[model samples]
Target chain A: MALFGSLFCRLVLGLVIAFLFLPILIVLTVSFSSSAVFAFPPPGFSLRWYASLGKADSMLQAVWLSTQIAALSTAISLVLGTLCAIAITRGMIPGAKAVATFMASPLMLPGLVLGIAFLQAARDFGLRDTYSTLLIAHVVITMPFIMRTVLASLSLFDFAMVDAARMLGRSYPAALWTVLVPNILPGFVSGGLFAFIASFDNYPVSIFLVDVRTKTLPIQLLNQVEMSPDPTVAAISALLILGTIAALIVCDRLVGLKRMASI
Target chain B: MTLARDDLAVMPAAAPARWTFDAKALIAVPGLVFMALAFAVPVLMLVGDSFVDRDGFSLAGYRKVLGDPYYIGIIGNSLQLACITTAVCLAVGYPAAWALARIRGAWQVILFALIFLPLTVSIVVKTFGLTIMMRRDGIINFLLVNLGFIERPMRLVFTEFSLYFGMVNVFLPFMILPLYSVMRMLDPRLLDASASLGAGPVHTFLRVTLPLTMPGIIAGGTLVFSISVAAYVTPGLLVGDRFMTMSQVMAKAYLNIRDFQLGASMAVIMLVISAALILASSYLVRTPGGERR
Candidate 1:
């Protein structure tokens, strides 16, 4: 039984590893399929689908809108999350752990629930602006990712450097900038990148908040699949795979993937 | 992940904050107040909406959601899907995480990328990829036929199997990451000690490794269950109208039918279920046998 159990475990894990990569492999394969339809073992190879993305006016617009929301929300979340992290680390707030958990609670709740709540809240508040509402919702969606790493980084940070700097003659702000900022830059960078990606890919909350003009990439991509079953979506996925590789390279250089993944 | 961070939050109270209110602490207020307004108020208002409609304090929505068999089945579907996904993820991820924790150097980086790469790609893309691959003439069907496993293409896409398959794929990383983190901290010597003491592989695992990784199991389990229960895009794209989950019902309620009351009730139930799972998991961690690391 023990041997069986162990073998079973390995077999499942091996299959799972393949399971993780197979769809990605297939998507990459289908993108270059000369066949317009989603046929495996393509009739031939071509970049027609990749070329098609340029003229995919709606997809392009959605990408641009998603980019704007992700960047802005990430910037906003970094500031907000970093401040909260600092306060949690430096402050005497009782149940600061609970507070930290509370800050990250948005993640534990369902996006659909949050979307519904935001929908009702926006209507009740008479917040009619789609772009701003979507942005606000993205901020909520992005917050926990920011908080998790920033807090993790802050916990690992040595604050006595700031105190020593303060004792030497630097003002509090100057002490923080010189000592604290450089030390935690990795955390901020990792957190911000994760936050940006989270916001960019968000669909459920954005779905409720997005009007016709404003839609995130995930929503737009899903619409494309439901509307037009073609290789264009696969090409976009392939590009996204490349983008992720680029991001991974940047992360590996800046902070090392180990540190980023650990957090 | 939060387990260690919970310690981080607790560690600071020993030293400071007793002075005249540190102005630095005020920095946290903006985020807090923003959450209170943007996050808390909205959820509370949603709960309020569930209780009231055009008829000033009505249970009509609750009646429809809880009292109707169809809505009850939808709730069951979400729970069933979440339970199955969490179970599959745990079953598959535990050994992967175990093997991962034991790996060193170059191989770790390669495997890590393989697992984490999909996460970087959007869920829409991942789910879409699954749909494309599961199509009648998709890669999966083609391979199965070529291998003589089946005579011809099977209708695989809009089935319960694909729904579970896609959900497990999406959520497996979440399970593995937490388990990997926890398992990496285990002392290999402990396993050796157990073996030396005549504990067989099963006994060693159950008595030593299993006890040690309980927190990871809970943490990963809670995280997977919470997200999978409320999954929207996965079910919507994979199975579509063939299956009904709470999220789809809520989306239809709010977006299509504009039934705020029904959507709000659904949201409340989901929140309550998630909150219970979180609380239960945390409570498990805080208990004596499952003490925090």
Candidate 2:
């Protein structure tokens, strides 16, 4: 009975995981199919769908735009989040707990709501649907990841090392730059990775804020899925999966899976 | 001469302490500026927009949202859907998280990767895959058909079932992570003690583990609930115009009807409710019934 129970549990778990992932797997297989209409099994295998991606000019543009936005947003999030983490964790703020929650307020709200708010706010500022507008929205949402990871690092950090550096007459900025950042580099890098992925994968915020020229990749994917269900989307999704896998590997190396599990 | 200059610099040590405030100000500068421009100011604008009309602050938007039965139904449906999704996620995620906490070795890495991988993908793409996979000719239907489980494919798309399916899949990781953290911290010897005292595994789990891990349960539940409540794309893409979630309703109000105020009102309501839930959950976790777990 015990063995039976364990087998049943594993089977259920495996099935659920498969259910969650099978769509992308199926899509990737179908993208290589020679048939005009998409199907589960291929009539013949070919690379025509990938070749067709090159022909889809809008997709190419959207991918480019998304890359630019994600890069910029990740950079901004790293800067802001690190600073906020330092401020709150180091007791630079009076009400550190309240301040931390305030910093993470955006997480509680939906992306679509944030997107619309940014859109209306941009209209007011005469920057509607611009790259800067989307960049700002992405920055807001992604900053919390950086803050969370950095905060986790701070919880494990040693203040005595910094005190010793200060006692040796090392300047405050110098102590922080040399002693503090190196120790926390892993968390910072992991946070940056998260920030990049968040910005890249975001759809709801981009949908409201993007224009024809500034449409992000996910937005383009949404448009494509709406108009036509094609295998090229599968190709793009497969590319995204590859990118995510790469990011996960990098994160594991930097922060360790144990730390991530704790997170 | 250099020694004399250094002595002169040392004489002004008092000035350095006075300038320490500048460092504090500098440290505070970046985060404050970013939040103000990107978050606080934008949300404030949405709130402001919700109240104002051509004449001034008016009841026009509120009246339209509240007075219309269709709009009221939309709000009800969104809340109801969110509540159901949250409950289902808790049910599914609790046991899975428990299992993960107990497991070891290669399986742990696989489970961790499996949970985290979905998080890295774009919501649009995930929903798109779900859209295809839940269709009449989709894999689920195909399997059912092949297994002779059903005579005809059920209408799964554009239904609440797909909405819950997608919600549970997307947010299960969130629930699992928290529960796993809490459960791992639990002392296994306590369970052993309970078993030695004639308690069975099920009884020990119910009495000892469940109560002790309630903080994790609350934290994960709140996080999942709030997220599901405000989720737009999954429900929107899966259900389409068949149903209106609060977020989707707000989107349509703003996009299709050109009712900015009404949309803002709905958005504000959703935000307030989500905030309240978070506050309540945090309170529960923090106090844990006025005793530490």
Candidate 3:
């Protein structure tokens, strides 16, 4: 009975893993297909779609815009989130746990609702700049990821190391820079990666905020899928898949996948 | 001189600490203020907008949402879908999460990475992949037809099945990760003790393991339910106009029709339902045995 149970468990795990990976594999395969339509077991294989991606000016612009938003928001979130994590973990702040929870609450809220709320608020406040509004909204979307990972890292950190450095002729800020920074660097990297990806790939929230002049990659890709229904979007997805693998490899190298997932 | 120096060093430590606030706590102020202004205030205004219109404060939006059968049907449909998705995710995620908890080393890391990889990718990409695969000429139908299992392609896409499949695929990791995390912390000795006490594996799991992992199950369920409830992109792409979910209605009202009042009310209703379900789940988990360590 136990053996049978264990076998069943393995089967389920194998199937689930396959389910998770098969779609991505298909997308990658389809991107290489020479066929214009999305057909599996491509009749012929070619890189024409990838080559055509260069000529798709709108797609290129969207990618650039997404990159800028993702990078800037992630950088800003890292700084603010790290400081917030430090204060919550180290300082004798009242309602620290509540503050932590509140900071991370955006992760739980639906993106559509957030987008709607932001739109309403933007209108109410008379904020007309779409670029600045998007940057701010992306920051809101990205901060929670940074805060959650950094807070988790800080919780496991030993403050005595910082004190120990202070005792050994290093000033307080210097001690934090020397001891704390190196220790929590993995958290920063992983958090920043997650934040950047989250911002870059964000769709529902970005959809409401994006104007004709400024559209993100996901929006552009969706538009392409709707308009052209070709392998071009597949090419983009395949590239994204590669990018994700590289990011995961970096994350695994910095702080093992196990640690990254657990948090 | 040595004794005087020792006294001076100790004096700094022994002096009554200034009752002034810890300035380090101020570090969180900027983040707190940002969330307050950008996140909390916006959500609050959204809820407030639902209650107000050109004719002063009113519940007309809610009345419209509730009184109209079409709108009411959307809410019911959303609830049903959310519930079904949550149940399916938990059922499917359990065995995999169990396997993940029991394993260690490289295989575990690889499996963990595989499960989480979807999360890093865009939902649009995943849904698009599903769209390609679920179409009449897509991989599944092609396989089914070629294998002589069916005479012709089946109507798989733009159905409830695809919606459920898309949602479960997207949110399964959320369920599994929490369960796996909790299960990994299980003490082996408890199972041994249960076995030695003459409890069968099933009996032991029912009484010991299940009870202990209830918190994880609750956490996973809440996460899955809330996400499934608010799901827009997958449903939008997969089912399209074939079905109407609250998310679709809300998006149409707000974005297309520009009915902020109607949309805000719908948003508030969705938020309330999600919050209620989550609270109910947590309450159920907590009240049953209270929280185990």
Write down the lDDT of every candidate, Cα atoms only: 0.86, 0.78, 0.87
Residue A43, candidate 2: Cα error in Å is: 3.1
Question: Candidate 1's residue-wise lDDT over A34-124, tens digit each?
Answer: 9999888789999999998999998899889999999999888888888888889875466799889988888888988998899889998
Candidates 1 and 2, the one with greater DockQ: 1
Task: List each candidate's DockQ score.
Answer: 0.57, 0.46, 0.57
What would the per-residue lDDT of candidate 1 be over residues B20-113, giving only the tens digit for each residue? Answer: 2465677788998988889989989999999998979999999999999999999999999999999999988999888777777998787877
lDDT by residue for model 2 over B66-157, one digit each (tens)? 89998889888878887888788787777677667777889878886786677767777778778777878777788888899999888888
Give per-residue CA lDDT, model 3, range A1-263, as digits (tens): 76787788889999998888767888998999999987767899999999999998998999899999999999988888888888889765788888888898888788889999998899889999988899999999999999989998899899989767766767656777899989998888888888999999898788888889899999999987777778889998999889988989978888877777666
True contacts kept of 3: 0.63
lDDT of 1: 0.86
Deviation in Å, model 3, residue A178 alpha carbon: 2.9
Model 1 TM-score is 0.93
Model number with the top TM-score: 3
The total of clashing pairs for model 1 equals: 0
The lowest-lDDT stretch of 10 consecutive residues in candidate 1 chain B is: B1-10
